[model samples]
Target: MPDPTATQALGRFVAGSDWRDIPAALRHEAKRSILNHVGCALGTARDPAVQAALRVMRGLGGAPAATVFGQGARLDPMGAAFVNAVASNLLDYDDTHLDTVIHPAAPVAPPLFALAEQRGLPGAAVLHAFLLGGEVACRIGNAVSPGHYARGWHITSTCGAFGAAAGCAGLLGLSAEQVAHAIGIASSEAAGTVENLPNAAKNVSVGNAARHGILAAMFAAEGYDAAPAAIEGPLGWARAAGDAADVAAITEGLGTRWEIGRNTYKPYPAGIVFHAVIDACLELRARLDAPPEAIAAVTVAGDALLLARGDRAVRNARDSRVSIHHSAALGLLRGRAGVADFEQPAVDDPALAGFRAKVTAALDAALPRGAARVTVRLANGREEETTVLTPRGSEARPLTDAELEAKYHENAALGGCADRAAAQIAAIWGLEEAADLGHLTALLA
Candidate 1:
């Protein structure tokens, strides 16, 4: 028999998946992904970008059917999804699939929650939808990666639409044919570029991914249709955006193996490539005989992708999050690499600014994408160096459930929702058994 088309195969997989068929371990991982996603969104709910999105959404009003997290107001499902997607991704601190560098949860989870709340769906349904959507995004990321990202497509924002559509379609109980149409529709909506990574424009693209996914699924549910090969045909998304899509990448072990299983959460609010740089610098800091201020020079070496993504001038907080020099300084000088370390104030701090100048980056092709080597030369005639291949929060060195909870609490405090953190935590932890999302959505607001 001939192989099925990419979109059709994906549609069928999503439509056919059962919550009971998913292993307990995968479900737990999905819960972790959702938990981390919510914390990241809540962490930046009051951020300038999020505020701007919320204000715009309020002006362009729709039915108040879903919660806009961290704010008291509710908006239509699309509006809520848009605002929440921006908030979760604005910090660049969300979960990552290392191979594709796609922040899967940011674009996928918002729509799932928004639709669940709007439809009064069970939390288990939301969780199941999130898992399938996140998996679809990562798999599509795999199909177009390396070249696609190298060609400047923002993998998360571009592939996220497909995940969003597939997940939302499942929640809507669309048939396989409808799900395929949803995926095909999402192909037209998929957009966002790596060139816009250092500014708020990037967040807008993520917002669009969430909003458009819902739009695609909604349209498909209404009997909208698209060409069957909308994703992999010569004129389709894969070839149109990049060199080509790897059919094997999208279809191999489609449902049995999970890409969400490979997901990694962030410990620092910086690009995942820079985590190893931070880890190495933190280690070198411990071994240095002199104070960080006494250090005359710092060197960071990593793969070409790291230098490509992080070797840049930091003009603001957004730039700082992707700046290798800034990450090195935070670990060496501040001894911590938290959200505050990447804020505008931190960017403008004279001490950090001066220290950033002391740091330099170079390429070592031998090093892995998330790996880094750091060398610090001090004025006291002492030098210290270290290498970190698997930084904290990586799948190999996963954050403990307790550590993840601490992160959630810290994010809640940062978003001024500390008073509600405990209840939010309880709701998320008990999500699978909940009747509906009302309790969780209320706490998010």
Candidate 2:
């Protein structure tokens, strides 16, 4: 029997739906997501990992197929897409869809931007392809959720490949059959490991996915062949990788429901899973008037998953972004975590080390996935406890538009875009009329 879910998803994506077809509120939300992603990419470009990747890409430079955002360098379509994707995710600051547990923008933006530059696509076309790609990535993520991730598969790379294929197919103007084949080819090539967690290599997974997806679409457009039911057939993606396949989730309300709008933006530059604990710690810090010296010890209690299964690289500044313990300690000592929060001095600060050493973390089986309780012990021997159910950047308590813009600007400036990259990206993203993608690329340059 054929896998109907993959067929239905591929069909809806190939139909070329407009962003206007989605609710006005949802469209605004989608715009916010794009802004958040661009902002993070701008900041991420400055990271050593991204710079290293760019240096390597420059060494292997080919025909000028696409423009790399921050470096002002051109590369072949696949090469540009890969490096740009790496830059966007190097800091782990991109927006994430919780249900699917995948960072949608990491894969979607690279291919869309690269193809737009290569083909001179308009802003409206770019936005449309972006939203469609996000939808595909999220649905595929939902189809394999928790299970695929549990099996040591990185969803950003595995599920992201399909998302990249969808985005590229839309940009390339492929037919439904061709798009399906692109997805099929993507499924076969999709791969990323969870073992690289919290390392720069984790970011590379998104880049690889974007590049592979673009290549798959380009090949399919040139009459390449792949399994039609690669997602749902025997030995398909769902069967081979997914834990509990939610076929209905992938197809239900396909055209009317917009999963892209459902994505949540991160206010802090850390893993989404640690947000709840960070919120709890920050709240505790704000409530106490005493200086850091006043605090004797801090204990954070949360779901066992965070303490045990959380990424281990977070013990140092480079790995701390994915470490629940590190984020919790940083939130209590510094009030927030950002790109600057992970610097060597900040990570090695005696004050932070003192707080970090005083902090004890444990898993609470009773706590929910996003719930966290933090207890602070003052020098006076008084303990204050607070429990947080949702983080500030979560859907339950999202960041305001102003906050999102500010974050974008901060990040963009860090990527050496002091001269209007943020404003230019926002202007192009909001344009109703068809504007050349060059305007946006120029801002990056």
Candidate 3:
């Protein structure tokens, strides 16, 4: 059975957390996370998926209470949160917590941004709430870890709802009891399966997480209640979603060890597991003496998780993002794996398609999750190989603040917001000091 007190314990911790209590380092990390999320959302502002979402939200419009990032349109808090969350995650480039593989900011930050913009709240409050929410999400993700995700649940959408609710609850000033109820409500609403990871359907679930999270908090504010042990009851979220919950993972490091600190931003726009494959392939490409056409075969070696997530047939851009073959081809043929490398045109490129057919995946039990070894055989009978245990964007080799800013600039330019990128960056950096988010929201719009 799950721990009976876990839900309430988490609620109490978030309810009582103070901005002053957070370490400076953690506070700065929160800003970094926010920056990355906004940049990702902006980067895809013009994507068809994001455009479709905006149209649907606009059609089902409510009060124009919040600004949609990179668009001039405003939506209700829930609508805005949902749309913004979709944008942040569409590129698969948001911040990741390596342990749980939860893209924390995509589902957590959108609601906080919506609430802050709608209520004219202070930026400090939003950041604090985001920190609390992301911590809750990652911790809950920890409780379910490999099992929850392996059982077909999308960790980001399923656990992300709880984070969104917790942040909204904190922002709404819900008491400990109310916060617990919010978490309970979130358990009933949270859902997203790994089965839909390949297409637009996956993004819808992510949007639902952000929207429903705010709904959970709103209901809690109205004195709505849920069973005290809703999260760990006989048939609770953990057991229902995964084999069992690691209750201690939830209760162990409440405030002392912030999970947000462990969050890492992505340098490549593909699945984190594929970063190692790209890195290894890039290294091999640099040493190759033969031309691209001379390559006979390429082998990618990684743990079972890597193969399970990445070994696939590439039919479109979305498929290429998680395909082992595509990543190898991009690194070996193009020498880079930027956003353009994963697009449909790139996926359909004659040379890249040919190279992809030459690439194959192999099991490597000794290699850890996010590590890869790639070997290439040339027509001349010569071979080149490389292994990357720690990819560029992993926790051990996180992107620096400047690199993150540069990434933001690149994304902003892609989304057609390059002109205002500098001001947006400045606004986000100075977010904690601002009394209100009016300037940021305006700039975002």
Compute each candidate's TM-score over C-alphas: 0.98, 0.93, 0.98
Give a tens-digit lDDT track for model 2, residues 180-265: 88888898888887877656777677788998888888998999978866887777877888554677777777767877777888
Regions more than 4 Å wrong, model 2: 1-5, 242-244, 308-315
Models ranked on lDDT: 3, 1, 2
Instruction: Evaluate all candidate structures by whole-model CA lDDT and list the values in order.
Output: 0.91, 0.77, 0.92
Q: Which ranges of candidate 3 are over 4 A from the true structure?
A: 1-4
What does the lDDT come to for candidate 3?
0.92
Q: Per-residue lDDT for 237-345 in model 3, tens only?
A: 8888876678889888799988889999999999989999999988888888567888999999999889989989999988998999999999989999999999999
What local lDDT score does residue 23 receive in model 2, on the 0 to 100 scale? 71
The residue pairs found clashing in candidate 1 are none
Clashes of 2: 3
Give the TM-score (vs. native) of candidate 2.
Answer: 0.93
| Top of the candidates by lDDT | 3
